[model samples]
Target: MEPPDFVRFGRAICCDLVQASRREWWLADGLGGYAGGTIAQCLTRRYHGLLIAPANPPLGRFLVFVKADATLHDNERNWPLFTNCWGSGAVEPQGLVHIESFRLDGSIPVWRFAIGDLILEQCIWMEREQHTTCIAWRLANAVERPVHLGIDLLVNSRNHHADTRPYGFNSIIEGNVNRISIGRAGGPTLHFHTDDGQLFARHQWIEDFDLPRERERGLPDRDSHFCAAHMRLPLRTEWSGLVATMSTTPEAPATDSPLRCGEMLNRRRAHDAARLTAAVTLTPELHDAPCWVRQLVIAADSFPIVQPVSAKETKKELNEKEQDRQGRFGQRKESVIAGYPWFGDWTRDTMIALPGLMLTTGRYASARNILTTLAGFVDRGMVPNMFPDDGGQPQYNTVDGALWYFEAWRAYIAVSNDVAALREIYPLLQEMVSWHLRGTRHRIGVDASDGLLSAGDSGIQLTWMDAKLGDWVVTPRHGKPVEVNALWFNALMCMAEFSRLLKKDAEIFETLAKQAKVGFSRFLKPAGGLYDVLDGPEGNDDSIRPNQILAVTLHYSPLTPQAQAKVVAETGRHLFTSYGLRSLAPEHPGYRGRYEGGVWERDSAYHQGPVWSWLLPHFAMAEYRVTGDAELAQSRLAPIHDHLLDAGLGTISEIFDGEPPHSPRGAPSQAWSVACILAAWVTLERARPSAREGMAKKEESRQ
Candidate 1:
């Protein structure tokens, strides 16, 4: 069998491919059947599909099972079932369609659907012999005559419950065979299963839905109904030859009745299946294979809906085919090198992830290309935080994105020994430092008070927990955050290193390093501890935050190992959580435990108390370096590695609840989360005490 293709677009993995009507997109495994949201919406219209799936691991195969105008239950008002599908046209109302599944065999679950002039037949084949499950879809010919038909597959596993209310959907079902009801304002509840602890093998489609009348082709209305009856057994034997046919009569020019095709609906089921088989066989060889193919296959078994198309295509796809062309070529280029799924829009994420996800995996040229792509975006020393989805312009909202660029640049240089590239990025690095001095919005203004940068007050949470809620900064350090200073110090050090390599401006290098040292000293509190911030009058919050850890972990810091140990010990005592370091300690009194209720309620706890899995690796590295305690570092990081495999399916999550039993929150498969893990792994393995001789040799070469 061919290896599944993984398409990387920004920070997502698109795993499987399917096209309904003219719209096209890919699916991810974790999001669960239709569980990945919005990523699968019709290209021509919004709100066309449903992503019904899980939020955590065991990213079984995702089902892009599609239907027209399905009536999904409305759990909010408990009202009768409502339709939430997209409208056929700008002014038309879409109708409701219904879908359900039943187990036909112990290993096969047959999917059934009823929709407007259409019937869907699908099944989950558990190929135990191959240790894989295959999800297959076949659309029966239902029209009276051979009328051209267009069908789009829409799955919404985002809302675990098949109900209309978004609230109930947010609550995760923790047990196997968890069931929920979708009833009208006091109507009978429809039973459904949220989790079935089985892996989905692969999604196999027998036929494509092709509707003629290109201009008139559109998805169903908003309120299009959706529901899935998950069966425990395999679907191969349950309803093998099940079929449904609808009778219809073609309306005359003056008639407004739905077009009918009575005789065509009664065609032989075997004939339909045969046609579908032919279509499936020929699809890969089609003149214009859909761009979603590569991504969908890779995402078929992972979380996060992956869109492999570059940020550049996000806008261009609105009107032309150029975006598709570019996306196809990009996918082809990546396929040859066994590259991981990547998204070009996220500069920081891509660069941060390049080494582990690409270079270390042996795609060196692609890694170089990714760096070069980001290098092109550097303007006046500022690398972009993200490339806008529509590709019009790049935004620089993040202060750390540029800093990470330098780190990634260093990593690239280490791997390729590319001094020329380092030299080229040096001036850009200088420009970024200059931009920081000039003060770009957000009191990230260079502080004349301590010579250490003072950032915050712009209502932006620059140090991650980046979500904003009105004027209330969630994890605000209104003056200077420890990590920002650490990065600033490291950036200067990197520039100094690069300058030496270029054999240029030794005096300038000394001056920059001196300034950085001064800044580091001033930021150190007189109490013999590194303060988390440099707020005046109010003084430092002294909340044990991970920001201070960077001061030791980064290559350049003025603090001695003893001081580093002090900061690390202080932070470890107060901030460390069993899962990872808490964004804020429980002692702060504002910490929230559970992260699954409402949006703000969840975000408030997001940084205030959440245990970020990504930070553990960094903290472990810092702890190891500070105390030279190999056992301590292993103790800190080992559980987290196990946790990643358990909760994230061999990846890492963005954040976890601050409280006990710290549940993972935020995006699963987050780029930084993965980067931090990979980077920390590299740090620990290379810096192991047993590797002391190797380290000495490496240090001598540097000297």
Candidate 2:
């Protein structure tokens, strides 16, 4: 509970180059901007840097401050504290041998370097909600003979996803002003400031910086940066240090104690943890949760960012009648990023992640904003599949996002008890149900005969397993999917509940839900499992997939208690892994065992066999329902604790290899992956026997 080994490295790993280099630490600036690098102080991914900031709030990501390249001087020898990897497969300087320690102080990353009788500690962090990064160095031990610390300030002004190949781009540095400005003609100027350092003008193209993570993703492995200037800081006494800051505008020297940055970030985490605790006041016994749960509470804050609506949508001229209604909603929309380093905001991901990321974290305002923003995008009774990164029109190809909207609103209204907000959107929800019944995009509508929702067409992937390359759609589930019907049934029940809560007529939704439940009986396979899909061009597909588990896990399930146990047993028998449940059963004829290679190769296996951490929560909830044992259900999530130490520190990964020793793959940090795990943790915490016992004692005392 005291942070676990999530600080990651122990004393043995301090000097190991290969092991240390494989681990990375990430720090966010809260505006979709981040900075990270390996524990060995080496760059392994193009995304790793001291300053990866958004020039346009959440887009136009650029790597401005690449590295500081610190070197330490003790007595007659100079030791490098910075490690570098070249295209020639050689690690230069070998700085990890300085042999100290690496750790995470809350969200901040701290590295200590020890040489001879001198010990220097360096910390890297960003100011909250700002594009500024501060690298503070303090002398832990006294340097009797003035130790000279040299730092090469390297800068880059290109997209973080692309590699720079030095096309004669250079910057003019006006030597050592209060803060020397570095930039090229007509580009943004980056301010560099130091409390105690001498600046020297230098220019060179540092080429062939190797990136192993990029290579694994089948991208260019080489990158380049420009060393614009160098700084020399002299330290002769203990507790004296130099702080170098890079920002859009120069930050005035910190007049107060220099311990504020680390303390500020830690305070931020504490505030978030307190907010989550307040939200869970319904369960007092879970108030004192373990340390890892609080860590996840902090990690959950990273995905929800303030995404303002585009000017085009907000500024469109409207009639006086429409303008009067527009006052109820504003343009300051909120959304959840699907993942880091690559993914933009996706509709299904946002909806699936809504409760865990925002609601569970007690961010009610953000949850409302996300729901309202999505409501504004509903067309033909469907929410857009995703909003493009370039601020273009939202895509409308998903069949599930609209259904999940009902579930999201159900959860929000149940917790917040803000019936006025639901009344405002009640008509919109009714209209969505109408359109779905009448049919919308991609043949998405309730089947007249069965009352089940059916979706998909040629050359299009509509479901969440929708991975495609060119015209070749992988895992083309083109018909009535089991999960869609479960969601559709759940949504109808939620609508009926909403109608009852709002004191309105609910007969239509109640009737439709009953009919859908009756239709869902067709999916129960003879083998005591649910069919993956039914009424398809290929007929009944009894693929033994994990989708059926949602039927039992959702708030409203169509299956009976015995049937729920059957689905859970089938999933556990073949699909369960320590990491998560596999996408496809291993015994299936077309199952792809491992996920590897380029886009097409990997996408082919994306749903065929890859394991997803997000699905673990569904099985955990279902297992708990079938067995009524909280600890046994929580045990299903035990391996994920070991996972937090590697890959993405303090967070869960998107996908893992389907084979044994399931290695983590896909986005290092995923929204639904984290939200689901946190939700599962809270689920077990709330169901603990102590919680029920405490409630009983309180009731008896009151009586």
- State how far residue 609 of model 2 sits from its true place (Å): 0.6
- The clash numbers for all candidates, in the given order, read 88, 0
> Could you give candidate 1's per-residue lDDT for residues 597-643 as a string of tens digits?
55567656666777776677767878888877765675665555444
lDDT of 2 by residue, 285-333 (tens): 4356665666676678768767533434433355574455455766677
After superposing candidate 1 on the true structure, give the runs of residues whose Cα lies further than 4 Å from its correct spot.
1-355, 387-393, 441-445, 448-450, 526-528, 536-539, 689-703
Off by over 4 Å in 2: 1-6, 142-145, 172-177, 185-189, 196-201, 234-286, 308-326, 694-703
Who wins the TM-score comparison?
2
Q: List TM-scores for all candidates, in order.
A: 0.56, 0.92
**Model 2 / residue 669 / CA error / Å:** 1.0
What is each predicted model's overall lDDT from 0 to 1? Answer: 0.44, 0.78
What is the Å distance of residue 310 in model 1 from its true position?
6.4
Candidate 2: worst-modelled 10 consecutive residues by lDDT: 237-246
